[model samples]
Target: QMQGALEQHLARLNELLASRGDYVQTLKFTQQLAGSIVLQLQGLPAWRGVSADLTELSGQVAYVEYYRWLAYLLFFILVLTVCLLACLGLAKHSRCLLLLMLCCGLLMLVLSWASMAVDTAAAVGTSDFCVAPDKFIMNQTDDEISAEVVHYYLYCDQSLSSPFQQALTVFQRSLTTMQIQMQGLIQYALPLFPTAEKDLLGVQQLLNSSETGLHQLTALLDCRGLHKDYLDGLIGICYDGVEGLLYLGLFSLLAA
Candidate 1:
């Protein structure tokens, strides 16, 4: 009977050791999975950073656009004032009005030449931008974004597929793969751990929001619309202003 009891005691001890081993392995697996999920979740912050940068750029461009429009408006008023003065000088046959008209005409002519000179210089500067806007923009950016990525969006051709699109595709694919892994870990690999499930669900939400932001960033980075606006500003301030002022000066001379 003592031998039978000793045999039972050994059996119980073996079972206990086996159970402990299984519990330790399970804990190790859980720790590893939790660490991986946390790492994957951290990637979402990059999306936030890109979004903020793009938005700030858009705002700055718009502010400059407002100033461009104001300059055009002031130029228009100046031209109108010169024309009205010339007309009054002719109608009233007044020497003072005529002198004023002559002075205004000279002023306009000088301004026209100055505008042309300034615009020419600006065009020379802008030519560099037209050639490689990405390089110009890179000078303004921080190290958070790589130069290669900026060039990918700026220099990419519309006739071909965009690198930004490819990046988004790959980004989404990676997120999907990681989410699948996390889901598997939570469901099959760690069902008994409700805390892991909560963490994984939070990660999934972050990834989902980041995916939405990525789509918006793709649209924002197109650069075509921004380029078009820049071209319009150049034409308005440089070409149109010069031509209008030249015509006004000629008309004033004819009146004299």
Candidate 2:
């Protein structure tokens, strides 16, 4: 009876070992699928070129913006000083102060016109680019990215399905199936085959890591994250930067 029972346990272990080939095949496919999805994401313009450029551009813009504020403040103080000199000259009938005021007024006029001209030109150029930014971006990319991909990110319509949704779904299903198999072996076969405990726990740990990767991949594949970055760059350049220029232009006009 003991020999018969030993044979029965060996047969069950053999069946489980046979099924492992299928599990290994599924794991191999899942790894390939993950690699393909990552490559596809990296190939897109949003990830490859646009994101890097925007990050660098943001840093540059911040540096320039700091100096711009300083220049504006100095100009404002100069204008105020000239106005005070003019007031004192008129009250005291002082010829020397009046002469100084006249010279400073002429200099202010020239600077004001130059600043206004630059601001107008910049505002116009920015407006032109904003009018049909999609075309401009497409042209710049030189046909490297498809229009469909660009539109998907630019619009970010909820109705549109994610590009990697199918692959992610398959990955999730395969992973879950693998986990279930591993758990079954840990529960049922571990008592019969004590040596397999270490291998089973190791596979469970690997599957857990894969699950974490899947979550990260899903977040990266989502359009909203990239779209938010795009919008932020536009707001910084178009709205904030241009608005500051307009304020500077107004100050120039007042100073003039």
- Candidate topping lDDT: 2
Task: Give the Cα RMSD of candidate 2.
Answer: 8.2
lDDT of 2 by residue, 25-55 (tens): 4435444544554455455345557567768
Tens digit of per-residue lDDT, candidate 1, span 124-235: 5555555655456677654666665555445554675644555556556665664565455446534554434444555456556656865786677675766666557557
Location of the lowest summed lDDT over 10 successive residues in candidate 2: 1-10
For model 2, what is the C-alpha lDDT against the true structure?
A: 0.72
Rate residue 99 of model 1 by lDDT. 96
Residue pairs whose backbone atoms clash in candidate 2: none
Candidate 2's displacement at residue 248, Å, is 3.1
Q: What is the lDDT of residue 200 in candidate 1?
A: 52
| TM-score for each candidate, following the candidate numbering | 0.50, 0.75
